[model samples]
Target: MMDTWLTNGKDEGADGGSPTVFIVDDDCSVRTALDCLLRSVGVRVRSFGSPDEFLKSKIPDEVPGCIVLDVRFPGQSGFHLQNEINRMEFPIPIVFLTGYADTRMTVKAMKAGAIDFLNKPFREEDMLDAIAQAINCHRARLSTAKNVKRVRARYDLLTPREREVFAYVATGMLNKQIAEELDISEYTVKIHRKNAMEKMEAANIVDLIRQATTLGLAVHAAQPEGMANGTANGASNRDKPSSAVSNGTEYDCTFE
Candidate 1:
């Protein structure tokens, strides 16, 4: 788990919420030059002389950013640092900077998900271009993570009966079919479905399905005739999202 001192107890940027470029290199000259160049273009930056220092210091995970990591260090290699950061909950994209270049090293880094690999004496244009691409990707990843969290929160807000109706309806069950399976009236099924849709903030059936997919909720495939004959059981656990909160019984969380 990374520390959080940079946040100063606020979500918005400790660095003005701007995308940052983190520089980790042993050479003082290298770190200073890169900082000046990046700051000149209105980019946020933080520099460290070694991998341990970088890992020890806190960075605001919410900041959209990339790392410019030196490929070779005295004790810990850049690859080692890369692997460590990749295991983090919110890993920053890495743009590798190496004074020495080789085909095998380049392939390995790219395979491990580095955004860019630049040889020493790299052009300013190339460096800036790589950093831009990395920041764009990191921003997109953060957006997706936020969306999933929001969907999960809404799912947790649903009543148990509403969640059951949601699973069935999302898989294309009619209110009548859902009512039959759950031992409720079609009118009641309709009510639950309506409430589920509202709580999930879905615009329509299509939108509702998308949100269900995002939730990773278990939904049996639609089989209307079999379901009417009471052949199908409840949803299976094969694809359930780990974060979803569920009750043991259908009426466990129903409200008056």
Candidate 2:
């Protein structure tokens, strides 16, 4: 997908986030008209006369924006730019504006993750609507990215010992069973368990379990040195991790 970006517009959308729109068109008149139109709607506008010119300028990663790109260029095509953007880290949306419309080009842009493909003579209302939708998509993507970063920060607070305890607890092992598995006292297991819950900011065992599964710690819990799987004993493997009862679809995250 084209997880690329372009933007700075006036904060006009009801959703209340700064979204910029970058317009890349070779025709000076087309760029001027689009710049004025988008600015009037409170979208921050930057226009470029060529894809090469836009590429030469720096776009910040923090700005959540979209591009209004002309599909056909003098030499370097918009599709080439889209491909380059796909390799970048940021998530930005793209909407193609073209006068030379065709079935093959439309399908190619859409398949490469463009938000919309509009003909050159497109109406002003339709263009605005498309830009607004692109901004919202960028916002949602940014929010999700923030959530993942926050979740990982919390996970990083755990100690290796706490992490081990977290894994056993996530798999639904009791204090006594975990004690035997790790060759530690039941009291020590309880201490580790309590510390793990606190470090993870988990409200309870279930919450901790969801975080473990979402962060994929439940899988890695087995790999630490001196930690044996149920292959060493039966009580650990008798049942599943018991995280299925949780409706934690919102806690989707992965610590790489």
Candidate 3:
């Protein structure tokens, strides 16, 4: 039996998105004071009296945001809620607030991936700083996710054989070795590898490996001998320069 309150307003951050600060505390007065303070700074906020009520809210997946959580509640502790959120793989950063602070609890909160843990009656500047840091962290995470998605979309444009070749190449396999493994000629392997590189817009083996790692693809420890010897289809170690976009920036593969 908890109440939920949402304060809506517009305040663009450096990234052009109005980030939200979610406040979950059992105390009504604490929630009100926080709401007023945050709104004064033009920050959007949503307050909940319990974790369950907060979880039931329809938070957008792409929103850059953070959570301010209290340490204790009637049924579930903040630590328990943190664990649940981690299990659910939600990307929002968390800042913990507590009246009873101890060394063990602080260590536990930090180890659990909390952005900050502040004792009750903390300084306003400290709270604001923690919230800003958390929002920045969340935004960075969202940007990375978007970049990964774009890379994955480019990967989807490759042919099936090219994808298989990409996997082998990313794992440090040479052209001849990939040919033998796939029961294809070395020339065919080379062609597919080139196609994959072009489609993925990978600058070199290093860049390809980075994208593959981001995609959670398994890679080998050894480097590709062909790339090391500069025999990768006579392609240079450096990536080829790309054409300019309408914005006058080079069309690099990096989403950042």
Return the top candidate by TM-score: 1
Output the TM-score of candidate 2: 0.72
Clashing residue pairs, candidate 3? none
Q: What residue pairs are clashing in model 2?
A: 4-92, 7-20, 8-20, 8-44, 9-43, 9-44, 10-42, 10-44
Q: Supply the TM-score for candidate 3.
A: 0.73
lDDT of 3 at 13: 29
Evaluate model 2: give its lDDT: 0.71
Q: What is the Cα-based TM-score of model 1?
A: 0.77
After superposing candidate 3 on the true structure, give the runs of residues whose Cα lies further than 4 Å from its correct spot.
1-17, 157-160, 171-174, 203-206, 218-256
lDDT of 2 by residue, 1-256 (tens): 1112223433332245466789999988889999888767566788888878877998866566889999988867999888877666555678899999999999998877788999988899878877777776765556655555555677678787766677778876778987897899999989989988887788977788667765655432444354455534433333433323222223221111
TM-score of each: 0.77, 0.72, 0.73
Ranked candidates (TM-score, high to low): 1, 3, 2
Whole-model Cα lDDT of every candidate shown, in order = 0.76, 0.71, 0.74
Q: Which prediction has the highest lDDT against the true structure?
A: 1
Candidate 1 lDDT over residue span 123-161, tens digit each: 888888888777766666666666777888898899988
